[model samples]
Target: MGACDRNCGLLSGAIIGAVLAILGGALIPIGDFLINKTIRKEAAIENGTIAYENWVVPGSPVFRQFFFYHVQNPSEVMNGSRPNLKQIGPYTYRMRYLPKENITQHSDYTVSYFLPNIARFEPDMSVGSENDTFTCINLAVVAAPAMYKSGLVQIFINTLIKSSNSLMLQNRTVKEILWGYVDPFLKKIPFPMERTIGAFYPYNGTTDGLYRVFNGIDDISKTALISSYKNKSTLSLWDGYCDIVNGTDGASFPPFVKKNHVLQFFSSDICRSIFGVFKEERIVKDIPVYRFVVPPAAFASPLVNPDNICFCTEKVLSRNCTSAGALDISACKEGKPVYVTLPHFLFASKDITENIEGLYPDMNEHETFLDVEPTTGFTIHFAKKLQVNLLVTPSSRIETLSKIRQPYLFPVLWLNETAIIGEDKAEMFRSKVSTPIKMLHLLEAVLIIVGAVMFLGFMVSYFICRSKKLK
Candidate 1:
């Protein structure tokens, strides 16, 4: 009877211990499930909210230039040319985004900026006196064909200053040409003002509603936002415009992605599209970042077209890519055209760069990349590079027209807008996000190991007691 009681007690102890151990083991997976669910919810930006982003362009990289227009064909008065033997830019450009205002419960948003008087022209050597256009190089203003249709011929003719039989520019700066000078007839921005960059006007951000009124005069010269939300998109900023393939947000990706994925986003500046593949997952200043390198194929996305970006760039006088490559925005300047090109002419053939002088195409430095926080889908670090060029085409009717031979896309400037989290914010993220995730992973492994050990220990004790009873 004593042996029976002992055996029975051991059996009861073993049964209870096994059940407890199994439940504890089960908790490992259950805990992980809960943790992931919490993360998805927390990382997701809620709808009806706003988020702000800040970026800065170092002055060392602000490059602007003007190529001298010369006669390639002495027979034709306005034929050929090489740019002035100089470069411009590397000027400091500071940019800030207003809280992206989420309008609807879904992905619709209005992205704006607080433009605190951007220094359009701060007295650079690039500028020349009216006399300099004759001796040195200068950007000549050309009237877009629309100037005639809009009945602005009279105004354009009126605006031209009479010079040595050539209608000359009034010693104006590029900013003065684009945004207008402070004149009685012209409305100049008084100081700091609000400018609308554009919005996700369409429900589908992949292709529509990404542009804003760049210049009030021309519909085609619209400024663009590189990213937007997709249909049924979350309030999370990355979901709408991040993926280059499907519209799904990377932040909403499963906890474990096996391989690199295709990441895409929109860019409205020159009205082009960009897509890249994420190569590796790594830590940036203690934050998890999915780094995407711009592949050569990325420029092929259809969104980077005239229909999407060029309102009428296709018709810009022999400026459109003959290979149907780049969407020329030079025509946007209905008065004088300034063409925009991807940094280093990424997609253009070698001939495009060869034909134009002053274009130092460097793929290594100019390729676009984005470093996004894997879970949050926010752009923490980025270097977006772009180049601006002035289309130098000679028009015979214009008196200011210098005798030029061949038309050239003169490189004016290139800029790099880089962004990174401030040091103070990085520390906060590490404490709040990075440290906690590591702890959860540790806890998960510990639970499984401890549960299995407890089960084995109890089973061994039960068998030993039974053997003794049998003896």
Candidate 2:
């Protein structure tokens, strides 16, 4: 009877162990499948979803910091000398995206909205006041000759400059330079044109464009990705693939972002789509994030990065090409000879940087980058840095520009639009997303380890008992 009881006990132990092992092994894959499905479902851009709430209105505070290049020797520059520059500011502003307008949801799992960018000056966050005055290029005088190619129009523009007593340089307050100011020369022109000019005159109180984005109901991977801009899938500004409007609106990205993923986004400010490549993994607010940076290849010369050939203008193509790191966006900026580059000409050609003084390019300060949590594709921290330059050439037709012997890309100002997840938002993410996922992972590990150990122990004991009985 005792032998019988012992045998029954062993049998019961074996059965329990086998059941645990089978259940745990099966759950390994099943648990993973469920977790992925839940994440995908939550990631969808629907009402009450985290993605939707974040997209409609971002929780992070975005700060737009402007750094102006004060040309110290405007007269010397006019006489063919390389312009000595002084970097002034971090005249900072708090950027706010007003609630989305014209929101329309489509049957094909997409939604459209118009987002307006609004900025308010923040004195405490700034290095200087907006009323601070600086000596800068008279953009109106410099841009006129380039805009009017016809000799007849050039003559008229030259007449206007002479009549208005407009010089190649002028002193203007930072507020007037960044917001809007009625250019004395521009106001006098007979032709209908934009008289009020500023670095961000058009941007303030303006909607970027109509953005139609994927809702991710059909495919979670495509969430928040822009399908079209202003009702077009491609822009009229550039040629071929460069015209294609790809990626999200820089507010949010799709879930399950991979390390090797090339994260693309349409920048209304630059009037083009840009992409970021994974640089490294970083920890932000105790959350692991993948750092993606705009590579130098994005602005490389056509020779080095053939994809950039489409961005080249007839003038640039005529010269074979401009050097790496300067993108001539003249077409996008209403025929203005505007070139966009990384702040302080970071990664730009020596030809461009050497012609200007007082530019110190530091990767930490100037590089454009985004830190995203890979699991949810939530951007924890990001800095979008860009420098605006004017292609200044010695125009013989325009008297004011005639004395300048050499043509150069003159740095005007740069901006750093940056944001990071707030502590409140970070805590919520940790509690709701990170902690839950971690707990599941721990449970899975515990189940696998305990079940395997119990099963193996039962097997060894059963074999030993059986061998002893047989002996």
Error of 2 at 342 (Å): 0.5
TM-score, every prediction: 0.56, 0.91
Residue 210 alpha-carbon offset, candidate 1, angstroms: 10
**Top-TM-score structure, candidate number:** 2
After superposition, candidate 1 runs with Cα above 4 Å error:
1-32, 47-79, 97-140, 143-161, 164-261, 298-325, 330-338, 399-402, 442-471
| Root-mean-square deviation of Cα positions for candidate 2 versus the true structure, in angstroms | 3.0
RMSD over all Cα atoms, model 1: 11.2
Task: Spell out the clash pairs found in candidate 2.
Answer: none
lDDT of 2 at 70: 91
Question: Relative to the true structure, how large is the alpha-carbon lDDT of every model?
Answer: 0.43, 0.85
- Which lDDT tens digits does candidate 2 get at residues 6-66? 6667777777777776777787788778768877888888888877777777768889999
lDDT (tens digit, per residue) of candidate 1 on 447-470: 556655665775687688778767
